[model samples]
Target: MSYPLRRRLWAAALILGFFVLWEVLCLALQVSDLILPRPSQILATLFSRMDVLWPHILQTLWTTMIGFALGVIVGVVIGALIGTSRIAYDTAYPLLIGFSSIPKVAVVPVLVLWFGAGPLPAVLTALAMCFFPIVVNIATGLASTEPELEDVLKSLGASKMDLLLNVGLPRTMPFFFASLKIAATFAFVGTVLAETVASNKGIGNVMMSASSNFDVPLVFAGLFILAFLGVALYVVFSLIETRFVGWANRKSDFAST
Candidate 1:
């Protein structure tokens, strides 16, 4: 069998084994549905309530994507500035770090206060959550450009913009895409967090309501849906990374093999 297929098969097997073990343990222990519903019960809830859940799922998905896209745009612009200019780096990087260090939970209420408890707050929260990683990666990537290469390009009369367009951005593709995968997950965290606290819709709110009602299975179902969406985003970005930055990654793959 091909190595990639074998690897995927192993992953699928492991996931299936995990669910099977969970089901068996739950059944054997006779775990109460209120405390820890079995996988079977969660799956049943997912199927039964999918119609009701669909709109919320869509809300969360689009909110995260929009926020992630905005984060990428803002991150690239600021990152380019910080990466290319010492003044911007020294002046802005520390503040950026501080803003990122603030717990996103603390920021959600302020967003709600500003935006008044709807999808807008969720979008902004996701944007804030995903912003730092992309900025740091893009800045690092641009800054890491080989000094010798820069000198050579300058000797050849390459302007700064030309160097950035021709060399820096391409070199940063791997780092940028890597950050996307991480930021994608963070985007979800932010959206769900804001949803639970500020909004009346989305999976976070659904889970919150379910918990309040002592519906453990529904809560787990919401968690499963979020996990699925997060994995989907991660996989999408991974494919894009392979498509654009595979040359940069080839060495790592070769070394691993």
Candidate 2:
């Protein structure tokens, strides 16, 4: 009845409609389960494999959370340091850019070598995938503080630390939260990639094994589970952003509505 509820229904309907259309097309075209399994097949595979899937899902969730946690802490600290000082920013930004430029998949082998092919490598890979965006966003948000505001605060005898604590951190909150959504998705990618390359457990391994066995429907089900987690995490962060930093976005929400 209400607008928000109506919007949710519309979104759910659209997703359902897409799945229905996909199912119909797959059925009508006689698509093989090996090539592009119907949604129905994927769902059946998921339900059938729950006994095997649960442990893999748990392993994935545990590794991803650990990595994401580490990434957030390190990224926030480095970002704060860089964002608050031009010297720090100049020194670190290029290095961060260079490091982030490297494809994370390439680093899985090196991580596996060091960590010996278990959750550690997956955690580290997830950490590597996630931290960069957070660092960049936080640094940009902090550095973007208005010069006029900085001058005013300075004229009033506010020290750099004081200004940063009072203004810069709060201003960067939105950027930090925004980056979390992106980081969450990246965390899963890193974890899965690592697991596929080296790990014995997790959804990545399940998917990889399924592929080798030509269980395409099972592979798709594994992918769906990962995607579901990513979407769930993104939603959680979005809700958090709206909850804690909603004040910062009050005007924007009003305008959009």
The model with the greatest TM-score is: 1
Model 2's C-alpha root-mean-square deviation from the true structure amounts to 2.5
**Model 1, 178: alpha-carbon shift in Å?**
0.8
The CA-based lDDT of model 2 is what? Answer: 0.92
lDDT for each residue of candidate 1 in 136-169, tens digit (9 for 90 to 100): 9999999999999999999999999999999999
Output the worst ten-in-a-row residue range by lDDT, candidate 1.
Answer: 248-257
Query: Which residue pairs show collisions in model 1?
Result: none
Cα RMSD to the true fold for all candidates: 2.6, 2.5
lDDT of 1: 0.93
Model 1: residues with Cα > 4 Å off, grouped in runs: 1-3, 251-257
TM-score of each: 0.95, 0.93
Tell how far residue 168 is off in model 1, in angstroms.
Answer: 0.6
Candidate 2 residues 39-73, lDDT tens each? 98899989998998999999999899999999999
In candidate 2, where is summed lDDT lowest over 10 consecutive residues? Answer: 248-257
